[model samples]
Target: MNNPEVYDIKAKLEAIHQDIKRLMEKSNQEYLDIMLANLKNDLINSLTSYVSDDIEHGLHRGMVDPCQMRETCKSRFTEFLENNTSLIGQENVSKNIIDEKRAELDEIRETAPFDKCDICFSEVNSLFEKQLNLISSRQIYSNTEKKQTEISSIPEELMVKSVLEPLSNKQRLQILKSMASETMTFTALSELTGLRGGNLLFHIQKLLESDLILQRHERGDYMITKKGYNLLLMLSNFLKFLEK
Candidate 1:
């Protein structure tokens, strides 16, 4: 009630969320490209400097053998991991952890295979998991500087209650899950969730009140808002991490 422009805030949040997602995707690809290129250069330099009596030339016809160099680089990377395991407070990095992380990364890759860089996705997940593990093992300082100076223009308690209210129902959660992947019309959503028109409308009104879903003015289709998507994602991640 304090802020008349509630929908405007929702729009701004969604726009910012989309911009950040695009930047992340772009940066991921660039980071992977540069990282692999640097590794290739390093491997070439190493192979070129060392000449065995058996194989006199590192290059075959003035170019590095990519197939052989790739194998050599893998071996070197394995060795590096072995040597630096203690730096991370572990005797050895677990193969199970690597496989688990790879599985999660593969799921993300499969969702948009052509859009994501696999190596970057895998690396990001691995790092995120490691950070979570570290945090669980030790206490970390919380950042409270912004919280100290920030003033809420709206009633903070009211906003919190409104955001949480729609999420407290089983039917509402099912509705959100149904619309997570795509926008849906009232009829389509009703069929998907098997809810009657009257009941579905009631749940939807709650979602709209919370600003978790947006309704199209022209066609009456409903879509999950950015806050809704982030809430689901955060909840999924938190449950997984906490369970471990």
Candidate 2:
């Protein structure tokens, strides 16, 4: 394809990817909320059961009448169990519905036309490698200047390898773009990236291992690390150069 046509196709593919991501996120969030509610309900039920057990023990000790407390605890426990059972059933149903929706979304993303631009990939990777080297050298310089000894110093070659490996994967690149603006939960990343939770988790694990990204404190949220941001900036510059 010609340059303009290629750019156009890339834009279209990116747009479709974004749409798939949004739908996936919505479905994932709904599923997560239901699961969390179910868990909370179960916890509450367990707490009530413990309290009831305590009340029963007290009655056996003759601290209170057995009849009234037994009736009250049994009634409350039954009601609690009933409510939780209903909620759990509803959550299961919702999960099935969301799974179907996610499947459809995945189909769309998979079928979207994405021209494999080997040239683009090559250029991006080259720039990424150069930036990685630069960053490594900078870190060494900073450590020497500070004259503060740490337990272990990060190896220069490892730094380059870490960034290079993830940049080689297109899916990981998409994940980086999705996380560029803000931190996202694992489920959100999966939905937006149209990757199954397991697959997304696998890629994320690699990214984290490479130090290209870091998990935030918000439970399951992830954000690009400083090295990641620097690499992204370098990629942006490379793109600009290509445009020129």
Candidate 3:
């Protein structure tokens, strides 16, 4: 029977186990060690639970698909993390640390090569939905408080000026409109806007200063941020109001 993917997954599982074991040993914190061990066990169970079933059904019948194996195991790991925040010790783990790690892992998953396995992809997607739910719930709580504080502390006049100044330029307006659809690189933006060199850089800087766009550090793609999307919605409403 074809089972190379199983073996490959087993090897990766062992590597992950060893990595956690080393971290646990190095930290020498009993609570942390216990947490890491629990995490490692969860990952093992997630990977191997489907192995026997797959063998019985003849799923891995062809050449080894490395991406499939890796993504499957990694998704399991992520799921464990999302579902088991209790693994974090009351004294040792900060919620901020967990949040940062989750954000980092999610960014990696987003940029990963597309997965062709529908089954594996579905599992990953479900886990992502769970993660998003958790994040949204947390953000709603925190942002409610944060928004109230900002509203009290920040001047409305200043906020209006900051927002309106960025929308003052016709060329910058065009750039923002295009970015609302999809991210573009510097060259793409230049071509789209027919602006280049210092002229393009000036507009991009203006958007950056306004926090309306985010630039990918490695790829240099400029994408609209949440603030930018909300601004666009507000612009639409304002235009409708004017029409009325």
Candidate 4:
């Protein structure tokens, strides 16, 4: 028969092991959370700046009225979208955004734009706020020669398999969205998604393999990686734009 004291000691060891595992998992998750936040902020800043430059350029191009003559501000915004977005291979995304912007151009044409610089800037600021929210992708090197080169350098087959395959399942998407704000253990996830045992694990494994999530250790809590968070953020932005 097994000794009672030996069983007590083994139980203590197991509990201690679990405690250490939790601490390590927490530390790792905190780091990932911070990185994801930074990435999100970076995307916002870049997109905001992209539009701001165009606004400034448009203002500069506005012809000063000679003898208080009225002249309509020919929109650089629409022309900017038509020229710039086509280069990025985001044909559908660009088209949708352009259509929304086009709706506003009719209203904008009513104003004698250069008359009040402040009002022009203020109105354009509102637009900047609305449109920037629609674009949250990694435009890190966007519209630059670097991005043009990077686009062709990427392997088409591998990239498609990696991004599209993992995102194909409803449960896999749920698992990712669930862990966006916090890390989750296997049991907790199974409970949240109503999945069980190996079935739950199979989905988790796909995310892990795709670098979309990180497991603290074997049979440990799962945390979303920066790639995972960024992808979801971009998808959310694009889908919201598409829905309108």
lDDT tens digits, residue span 11-125, model 4: 9999999999999999999999999889867765665566656655644454343424323332544453434433233323443554565566555546544446445545554
Give the TM-scores of the predictions, in the order they appear: 0.36, 0.35, 0.36, 0.39
**Model 4 spans with C-alpha error above 4 angstroms:** 1-154
Q: Name the lDDT value of residue 199 in candidate 3.
A: 98
lDDT of 3 by residue, 153-183 (tens): 9877767666878888988888999998899
Worst lDDT 10-window in candidate 3: 55-64
Q: Tell me the spans in candidate 2 whose CA falls farther than 4 Å from its real position.
A: 1-160
Candidate 3, TM-score vs. the true structure? Answer: 0.36
RMSD of 4: 19.2
Candidate 3 residue pairs in backbone clash:
none
Model 1 lDDT-worst window of ten:
51-60
What lDDT does the true structure give each of the candidates?
Answer: 0.60, 0.60, 0.66, 0.68
In terms of lDDT, the best-performing candidate is 4
Tens digit of per-residue lDDT, candidate 1, span 186-244: 88878877889688889999998888889978657899998888888977998999999
Q: How accurate is candidate 3 locally (lDDT)?
A: 0.66
- lDDT measured at residue 169 in model 4 versus the true structure, 0 to 100: 94
- Cα deviation in Å at residue 32, candidate 1? 57
